[model samples]
Target: MSEGVKWTVLGDDDYLEIANNGRKPVKASLRIAGDIPYYGANNVQDYVEGFTHDGEFVLIAEDGTKSVDNYSIQYAVGKFWANNHVHVIRGKSELNTKYLFYYLQTVSFIPFLSGGGRAKLTKGKLVEIPIAFPPIETQNTIVSILDSFEELSTELSTELLNRGKQNEYYRDLLLTFPEESIEV
Candidate 1:
């Protein structure tokens, strides 16, 4: 189980598919809700109605400002949709989607775009890229640790937002106080 694991192209998953290489001419009024996480080229932008794939899977941006770094690995798991500018990497039994997602982030797999322009990542290269696989238990542990860190980071962000609001309120209150009349 540890060695010679079978590797397949991402297209093997019928439900999961790569996003269109080019951006849509018009932006769709799409949004994710419920269990579906709508992913964009850069990151998870919003919640969507439904996901194209089931179970844990990885998503990579296909095109956009963030897609320039072919090696800029931005991956996420759970039910999600690969937006027009993203690539969905589904995992088989041998590989864990979360583990693959995190691993991809650490590797320089993204291809460089030329002509001093935004890089566009394609599915062909993504599927052929080599990824390291560890034991399932080990992968789970790593994912768990990362999840804990994420929770803490989120809490800190909320605290910072609250503090900012409180500061703003006090500043406004102080500014509103009438200035003492200056002697002419």
Candidate 2:
């Protein structure tokens, strides 16, 4: 996508759901062909479904108990959903979702969230938020790299957990062996 292209907000597609308060909920099903990283507002609550976004996009929290200061939880695209609480964005051929997601992350757009009871993201401010899109290829490269890092991190975490369990098992086994010293 190029900067010259036109862009539109969630309202344009009728996807914008104005909440009673001033926030929206991130709720959408996403599906990526490859190792696309699926994300959610509170975290990975679910996996991608059939529909998938090819390009990059921005995800802003719309409604929730948590407070987001400037698009804190944003997701780049390989394939994912914005969910109900989040606003998914696309630049008219000019920008990809990844670029927008990254740009929003740098700022705190959620400051506008307001609602005594049920809060929601205001459509007016959301559309007005400025974003910059890098070249599509660049966005893809970045997402790919980031995905790799995320995968590695996840793997490491799992490995660490397994190690912890193994250590506990050995400790229990040694303790069961009556010969082991037991401090009074």
Candidate 3:
């Protein structure tokens, strides 16, 4: 947080709405295969039919995260099915959902997690996370900066992949002997 700047603390519960009611995990054997992404504590565990939610929301791992320092956090949009392992939430009122999504990436979930084998972020602990988000204007500016970086990274990666393919094509062309000059 920059000095003299206003930041919203997590203690203010009204800033966000914890919408975990839609979380319901089905057994793998009973799952109906489809195009909808089925979300777990980490990532998409599977693609199945029937969506549990149909809006923009943030998902934090409820349990099964191997490392507390690198707990799973995802920004999901549109239709999706979430299991019991993830806590679903969204910004309320004037808060920007994407802004919170970006701010959470910089947060360390270690203090909020519990459990022995698998780290768990309970609803109580989740709300207790010591996070301070900047005001909406600053948050939107930060989001814009991060999004630009992400877009540029994607472009560089695609260019590198295309360059590799081009190199392989030229390498083969340079190494091969002409068929017309080869003796049978």
**Alpha-carbon RMSD of each model:** 5.4, 7.9, 3.3
Model 3 per-residue lDDT tens digits across residues 147-175? 89989999999999999999999999999
Pairs of colliding residues, candidate 3:
none
Residue 161, candidate 1: alpha-carbon lDDT: 100
| Best model number under lDDT | 3
| Candidate number of the best TM-score | 3
List the candidate 1 regions with Cα displacement exceeding 4 Å: 1-40, 43-51, 65-80, 112-116, 179-184
lDDT of 2 at 69: 50
Q: After superposition, how far is residue 52 of candidate 3 from its true place, in Å?
A: 1.4
Cα lDDT, model 3, residue 118: 73
lDDT of 1 by residue, 1-184 (tens): 4554344444555323444442222234645255666667777666667665555556665567453434545665455665676665655565667777777776564443323466665566665565566666777788899979889999999999999999999999877855575445
Model 1: number of backbone collisions: 9
Clash totals, every prediction: 9, 31, 0
TM-score for each predicted model, relative to the true structure: 0.65, 0.55, 0.83
TM-score of candidate 1 relative to the true fold: 0.65
- Greater lDDT among 2 and 3 belongs to 3
Tell me the lDDT of model 1 at 69.
35
- The alpha-carbon root-mean-square deviation between model 3 and the true structure, to one decimal in Å, is 3.3
